[model samples]
Target: MSDLKTEADSLNRAGIKLSYAADPLNHPLADFKSASHDLSAFGVLGSLLKATGEVREGMTELADVVTALHDEWQAEGKAMLDVGKVLDQVDRLLQESLARKHG
Candidate 1:
C-alpha cells in the first residue's frame, strides 16, 4: 500500500513536470505555424512551405498526444491514491473488529 502511494506520488510529480514541458512546445508550434503562413505569401518557396506545414501539423499532433498522456497519468495517480485510501480504511476496520472480538 505504501509502495502504491509512493508510486502514485511519483506519477503525479511526473505528470506535473510533463505539463510544464509540454506547455513551452505550444508557443514554438504556434510560432512555426505563423511563420509558415508568412512564408506562404512567396510563390518560390511553395514546396518548402508545404513541407513546413506538414512538419508543423505533426508537431501539433505530438503536443496533443503528450498533453493527453499527462492528463491520463494525473488521473491514474489520483485513482491509485483513492484506492490506497479505501484499502487502508478496510484494513483498519478489520483490525478493529478483530481486536474487539478478542478483547
Candidate 2:
C-alpha cells in the first residue's frame, strides 16, 4: 500500500538519522586514542579517561536500541508479507464461491 510505503520511508529516514548519531559512539576506542594524544600534547584529555566507562555503557545502550529497531522493521516486513498472502487467498476463495453459486 502507498501509505505503508510512505510510513516505511519515513521510518527509514529516522533510522538513518539515528545511525548517524550512533556512528560517533561506534569508534570510542579510536577517540580515546586521539584523546590520549591530546593529553600528551596539551596535558588535558577533557575528562576523556574519567568518562570512558560511562561512554562505553551509553554506546552499548544506543547500539541495543538500534538493534531493536532493526528487529522490529524485519518483523513488520514479514507481517506485511503475511497479510498479502492472506488477501490473495481470500480473493481466490471468493472467486471460487461466486463461480459455484452461478454454476
Candidate 3:
C-alpha cells in the first residue's frame, strides 16, 4: 500500500509537470482574460479529479487543456512565462488535497 501510494503520488506529480510544460504560453498571457479562463478550467477539472483521486481523469483533463492552449498559442503567435506558476499551483493543490484526505 505504501509503494502504491508513492507510485501514484509520483505519477501525479509527473502528470502535472508534463501538463504544465505543454501549456502554449510558457509565459504569462498578455491578455490575462484568456489566461484566467484557462486557469479556471484547470482549477475546476483539478478539483473534480482531486475530489475522487481519479488519476486517469485528471491526466486526461490536464492533457486536453494543454492541447487546447497549445493550439491557442500557435494561433496567437506568442510565448508565455506562466507555466511554472500553473504547475506549482497544481502541485500545491494536489498535495494539499492528499493531506486533507489523510488528516
> Highest lDDT, which number?
1
Q: By lDDT, rank the candidates, best first.
A: 1, 2, 3
- TM-scores for the candidates: 0.60, 0.53, 0.26
lDDT of 1: 0.62
Candidate 3 lDDT trough over 10 residues, lowest sum = 75-84
RMSD of each: 4.9, 7.9, 21.4
TM-score of 3: 0.26
lDDT of 1 by residue, 1-103 (tens): 4554465556556545544554556677667646644544444775676676676677667756766765775566566556656665666676788889999
Instruction: List, residue by residue over 25-97, the lDDT tens digit for candidate 2.
Output: 5476445544543434322576665565565566566656765765665566555555555555666676778
The RMSD (Cα, Å) of candidate 3 is 21.4
User: In model 2, which regions exceed 4 Å deviation?
Assistant: 1-47
Better of 1 and 3 by TM-score: 1
Per-residue lDDT tens digits of candidate 3, residues 1-103? 3444455455555545554554555444334423433433435665564544444455556656866876664443322224334445666777788999999
For model 2 the TM-score comes to: 0.53
Q: Worst ten-residue run, lDDT, model 1?
A: 33-42
